[model samples]
Target: MNHTIIISKRISIYIIGLFLLSLGATFSILAGIGVSPVTSLPYALALTTPLSVGITTVLANFVFIILQAIILKEIRWKNFFIQLIISFLFGFFMDFTIWLTNGLPEATSLVLIIVYLAISLILVALALLLYFTANLPTMPYDSLTYVIANTWKIPFSKAKITSDMLNVVLSLVICLLFIQSFGAIGIGTFIAAYGIGKMVGVLLHKLQPSLKQWVYKNN
Candidate 1:
């Protein structure tokens, strides 16, 4: 019974994390300034394609999983398949959140823009907190960086930076080739890419003790 309870708790945390992550990403996209770097490519694709950003995100993340498998030169078929299911769930949650907020007016005024940015940052930080705490199957984009870092024997931080830069570059290329405009890549993209980590770090630092206590007490 104890083991079952612990497993249930962990699964609940993971589901909450996915929910917050999808909502946060939707908030960023709806902000209309731009999306985070990890999402930039998908957002760009959505502009030219008929699919919504949520659907494009699922497809892009699937490709990321395939790339990770290729780079690792070995695949854990079970985990790979599980991650695909999680990715689809995340994508559907994102679409649902976007639908919920579809009636929100576009952020136009200076105050509204700042408010949107602040909300986006906070929600993303909270999402990261839940994600790291759950200790579940890793997201595909994150797994790609991990696989690359291990394969190249480079620092994970360096590998992650490289991955993000590559994502931005790829998004730019897609924009140039198809849209002939850079509307999807803007200041918010860079802010999200860089600021979110710092925000998550600070939040985790401040909340770690309390979070630990909660987990231990629950256990």
Candidate 2:
């Protein structure tokens, strides 16, 4: 394939991934799942800062990229720019979805929450699907785990487990601070998040080949 053509194709897949990520985020929030690591930054900021969640997300990701650059020193233009664009896109869609769902009737609210959970779980699967479609850098969180493992000469699986545990603990802390002390977080949020992420990773791997091609060609 022509190099330019390949680049274009990858960008298209990334756009699709961005939409899926944004919708997944909406589902996560509505399902009351523990907030995603990156998303948690915005949630925390929302407590004290007057900024919107979407803006806060972009700001946090920018800071994260800077930190990664300083620490790893392998920050490439394509990967950094692509991640930034996708984060911005996801944030936009997330805000839209939240607005669309916030006004549901009582029964509708319950039904929507169930739908949110189901979609949130599947979104993780879709994420893996979308990830392989681009055949590019994994998400930033995964990339960090890889670097940490490689630098420390540890097994990738071990690194992944530790990273995930860190997120889990961090989520718990956020829940404690917000729902327990500050009184903002809710029940079932962290549990749903942790469970759905694991379930999705397992389920997605089984269907990776087909999902990868579909997300690549169809999207």
TM-score of each: 0.94, 0.71
Residue-by-residue lDDT tens digits, candidate 2, 50-110: 7766776677667656656766777777877876876676667667767776774332466
The lDDT leader among the candidates is 1
| lDDT of every model, 2 decimals | 0.83, 0.62
Clashing pairs in 1: none
* Pairs with backbone N, CA or C atoms under 3 Å apart (clashes), candidate 2: 32-189, 33-189, 34-189, 34-190
Give candidates' CA RMSD values in order.
Answer: 1.4, 4.1
Best TM-score among the predictions, by candidate number: 1
